[model samples]
Target chain A: MTSDHDTPARPAGLPPYAIARQGRRARYDAASVHAILDAGLVAHVGFVADGRPMVIPMAYGRDGDTLFIHGATTTRIIRGVAEDVAEDVAKDVQVCLTVTLIDGIVAARSAFHHSVNYRSVVVHGAARHVTDPAEHDHALRVITEHLLPGRWDEVRPMLAKERKATGVLAVRIAAASAKIRTGGPVDDDADYALPVWAGVLPVTTAIGRPIDDGRVAEDTPPPPSLAAARRKFA
Target chain B: MTSDHDTPARPAGLPPYAIARQGRRARYDAASVHAILDAGLVAHVGFVADGRPMVIPMAYGRDGDTLFIHGATTTRIIRGVAEDVAEDVAKDVQVCLTVTLIDGIVAARSAFHHSVNYRSVVVHGAARHVTDPAEHDHALRVITEHLLPGRWDEVRPMLAKERKATGVLAVRIAAASAKIRTGGPVDDDADYALPVWAGVLPVTTAIGRPIDDGRVAEDTPPPPSLAAARRKFA
Candidate 1:
């Protein structure tokens, strides 16, 4: 589906880590990359701790070209980078956040040939602390709106003390790449004769029936955003 | 759904990181921790590079209590940990792997309070290189079978060169902990009167219609393992 008119305003370069599969290579364009990020709710953030690597999955949101992350103040990874003071231990470490969606399964006849069809975005940049109060507050709103649009205006904003207690960070998608795979399975010619069922098993995200909170007022109606997501998915 | 009859076989005393979460605090129980790990497919792994932390999502398998990970020889992270290598980089380092499943989206009346219902597992331990060829082969099979049961038998075995070119490493899951949050939206009593949705949007893993591989022989039948998984989820 890629065409000259489908390119995004932001140009997409190649991934630093590239692997070739002859016919299995994915086409990269701006629209394709943004779509993957928009459809995902969680991101796996990788960083170093004690001179070693670590990965953590957390919720994320994007504002234009920037991505925001929020977490507990007690988390060592966030606190270290924010305070710039290594607690009796090293801190101020660089981190990378990645989002990926498993679109389908590629069932190849040869075991070595089996692969998962997926869309993934990897952001490489320095993860510094957010010291500006206004910037921090807006970042939180961006995150909330990203998940539940229009809900930010409906709910109470964060308190000064509460905001201080939570750590929020932002990184631009300046140096990043997206990879994707779609379509039927690929099998070796000789193995095609072997009796086996091989094909993609599609996976999708759907919103389920809403479970009302026990304490909700007997007649209160759900907001349009909540109702709309449910009805659309249903 | 926790049962009083179930008990965990843990070491004599509670480890520092294995604390239990009762109320809003996170606590560690052996059975709950193991269950979270067993249910996960892959883990985000972290390590440090040039004063920065790098986290990569990778396939992993567990046996007894040890976690195994492998990668191509050319990967910087793997080569850094190689033994008798030209680089003076430490081959072993402290690493953590985390798995999380978001059960639902808890839409609280207050935007600042919005949170997801999730269960997560974190493992902390020292990673050691797997040097023995036999252990290396066994580890690779575990990784394959973990992703696809009965896959090890169907695929061609690894070649000698292939095994040598791949770096296999194992880490004991010690000082591990798990944290979980479940239930409907928890909103303040006053917020209940506000005209807003307060409930959960349940999320589930679903498999769709399977697409047959074009290259598969017409007479081929689906494997039992794949069929069984489909039925169980269906």
Candidate 2:
């Protein structure tokens, strides 16, 4: 039931469905997948709800092979993983989590060749409902720190009420792939000689100077954690 | 069967399932949804693939209420829109297209309340396999122009062979919602008085100076289309 009905030509270790027949730029190695996931800030988490598919932006954190996402226990995903195709399956709700970082815009001589320079990872796995307090606390910290590294330690600890209200879902990377495109566009060989100008317009996510809230002292500078995040993003 | 099990308290015009119960920030108006979609560069498209959900980042273009995504004719959603719940449904394929723009990082005093400032649009609808030649060509142009406003006129027109090889899928947004969060961190009243500095670190996608490909003349300046895109992105 994988997306591709063609011959199974995927590299070793990946599940058949994660074979990545969607495009020509797929890379199946874990290094590429982890790197893209670690660098990404938001994940487009797709899950079924009421027989229809829904994709939403969510902040995620990576712990080894597992990806963590949290929200109110009442949310569609947190409440249930959606109906599984089979009752015998381990988990009813499955998820497709995708992360992408657009590196640049490839402007080619031909419109057909125009493409984006990007690095992305797509993960398919079961949505494990996390209830263990220790695991839930760790997942929250991981998610918080993933965005602003050391900011988690500087911030107040999670209160009991806060922990109770939050629900965590873990998706183990059962199958995944990273697809990347870089450098210049590959134009039609004949069009490469055309008068049109072609090259890469690099697109990057830039972290700007931090603006402090009014309540903080005028002289109070950004903390070390913020500085660390600044360095990483810069 | 929409995702939410809550009362249909949605504003007029939107379907019950399109209601945003995911978080506190939700905007159902077309203006907000279109604005976010227009500014976005990549869309994470989710559809049922082999009984499980799959989400992949795609470059998309908007034409009024329809979102167009093109790929090889054999791709999952391009060939057919996943499965429809009922046998008698008009089209068997349903898709969820989502676009997100990260505006900033909210640095809150409590880890529990920390969040990202972003604008996102999610659309759920039936995926129509586009085959009409004129609409197909126009959809491609719309997609190109959406990314680089005037690049279509500058680049060589898409060739007949290119069109033959490509497949376009249009999703007339059945139900959509936009969510936006902005400004500095909203900390607890007591924590706002804490000595810790709190602020927002603005996150932005920066388009850098365009570099010409080797084939172009050294003095050949970037075309007007690229300049227009730079102005828009800048």
Candidate 3:
């Protein structure tokens, strides 16, 4: 239902890498891209490894246009970026990061036309290791709060030793695009006459009741923030 | 809890590409790999385009050890593979397919240790066009049933012309590995003493009420298969 007047202008120039094959589905507005990125719980990060493409799912968080991802310092991907810097081959790691939230399964009369209703954001950028202590701390807070709202304040602040072991990479989205498909299935006119049911089966990620860890004291109750999150998605 | 006696033997020898930096998290048994792939609703297919890694989310189905992915013949990924074949660069398209199901959000006492509980499968292999008519039809059936358990039988059979417009690729399970993390968060011993609520917030992909297309007859009820799916998730 997006009309030319209602659609937001593309703030970031639409780079060739971000163009969609189905031009109608491509969106370049910052609002559209950020919304998809915020809704997704995990991002699949694509990077070249030994001349082969490797895609790994990782939890991510965003602050403005910068997306933060972290892993153990010893992990292959983190170390790979470090090696790139040491060799001076590249200042940042080239990556294609994607986040997708599937909204429904679109069942059409014809199998060829069956599709899924989804919102996805694809970002192409060079990720560099975050060196500034202030930015690193803020990025960690963003990541922690993204998964658990109000968690950064509730939990103990990260110890210096723990910070040393974590590798944080910040990728300022150079070029980004959001592709969304919603509503009911779009089938061929001739196939609409077929005596078959066609519609959308909505899909959602629901959060179930919280389970306490064994170490928790019997008197200690679930935090209000945790309980609220469970209720929000329940 | 996985016991050494209960863990299945690794059927496919661990390929260098399948190994995880954290060795303890990697599982190579066919059972482990297949279970993760089955539970996931989408796969992120990684392929090289113009020497840059492109990761796109796709709906996929698994039959035995093989995975099938289909899209419109006009799609960029499909056409890219076709061009590769036409140029005689390689008979198959090199791809890294990944599927991930986020089971829960792990809220740890320290932000550095926060992680998601998930099961993921990564398959490194070459995908080639499924040109055989019988295999193409079977692959389509696998895809239909994978999304909606009994959908293939209830839907109208695909018309010849409909099939002609679809492009399907099959990737054999070569060098596949599964990585899983479950249970509550594991925090540092000192941090565990902090009075912070830390546990797993369970997550699941649930199906909501179906919305029928307006074109369907007023008396035409939702098929039994659709009803069954709703109940399964409910």
Candidate 4:
């Protein structure tokens, strides 16, 4: 069943990452891609508008190999894409989606050789509008649940009018690659005694105590799943 | 004296965030521009290649609103920019630079209404070539030390030939904006009893103990600045 949802399978290894990817390539598997996407909460989205490459930072969610993004209907770029598609215009729309987790900092003996330890996934594809209401609803759910687990069950469903007003699109993960760097810094032999501090400053994401909205009467405690996740991170 | 060196002369009310700058439709002030560049460790660089917008991740540093990025000299994008400048020609170049910090996740009563609290800066600019040797060297130092903190004082400096072989360009930050989204999720009054979890999953960058390179001589200890920073984070 899950395989049915797998990103339109790419010709094996069609979009190999550049030298940077080769030098720090991760295990390119479905699990790896999903894990990286799941661990990430924000994505830097890039697209061309007015023939200029523009990047916007936004919240995103992923299911299988498909990534879902949405924003205000007033967002200029989003409107442009929708208008172009509504006109049945065959527009060449290229979108690049990327997520990065800076696991640590690699300090090398030589300043010239310092590097960051990170896991990043870069996806390149032609973005198109999702016109079908059911599919659009599902995509929005994927996005919502990605940010807050079990959220789709708790919130009021999207109304027809509101859904129409929000411009949401689905970018099928087509050409993609995962690049990762880990472990300690690589230093030159001669520079070993240069007396520079060289090591990995590991970074992690942690959650804090939950603060209830003042509107909640009696300050209701957080939900079970939300409370459990917070404890795990804490 | 320390304030003068510790903090750049930041302009008053200059929004230091790129996304906030964009949302407010603010202009690029020198101090706001510098702070965004200096505080960032890397940038998502986008450009048109083969009539497609390609977003590449890279490390960058800033001197004022002018940003410097480095890569292999033989790279196609770098070569193209250099040729255009060497011939005193103008080419279509569109780039976006963004820096973002994810503070927390805002979970609303309704799943469709989830959001994130973040601060981001975006720069829309035409990236040009930097061919001057003196300027390139200065940019390299800024980029290197910006990421590694105090490593410049410990590592062997770059050589003249090495610097020439590496492609470095300083692109001015122009037409920038900083848009910000903060606070908890906003949900409709009717949706409060949905029985779904609704609270922010606060995200923080936690730096952990430094892991020394195994090859380092057994007798050596971490430098005071680095060791102390690690302790502080610990």
Rank the candidate models, highest DockQ first.
Answer: 2, 3, 1, 4
Q: Could you say which candidate leads in lDDT?
A: 2
Give lDDT: candidate 1, residue A213.
82
Predicted structure 2: lDDT? 0.76
The segments of candidate 4 whose C-alpha lies over 4 angstroms from its true place after superposition are A1-28, A87-92, A225-234, B1-36, B74-76, B83-92, B192-197, B218-221, B224-234
Ranking by lDDT: 2, 3, 4, 1
Name the candidate, 2 or 4, with the larger lDDT value.
Answer: 2
Model 2, residue B205: C-alpha shift (Å): 0.9
Residue A190 Cα positional deviation in candidate 1, in Å, after optimal superposition? 3.4
| Candidate that beats the other on lDDT, 3 or 4, i.e. the better one | 3
Candidate order (TM-score)? 2, 3, 4, 1
Say which prediction, candidate 1 or candidate 4, comes out ahead on DockQ. Answer: 1
List model 4 lDDT by residue over B86-154, tens digit each: 465545355677776677878777655677776566676667676677887787777765665555666
Every candidate's lDDT: 0.62, 0.76, 0.74, 0.64
Say which docking band candidate 1 falls in: acceptable
State the DockQ, from 0 to 1, for candidate 2. Answer: 0.49
Top DockQ: which candidate number? Answer: 2
**Per-residue CA lDDT of candidate 1, range B1-234, in tens?**
010111121232245345433324354667777777666645666555455555555667778677887766545456556743444443565666676665777778886668777777667776777877888878877765555666667655565765776777787775666768798866766777776768887866565767776766676676654654354333
Q: Which stretches of candidate 3 lie over 4 Å from their true place?
A: A1-22, A87-90, A218-221, A227-234, B1-22, B87-90, B227-234
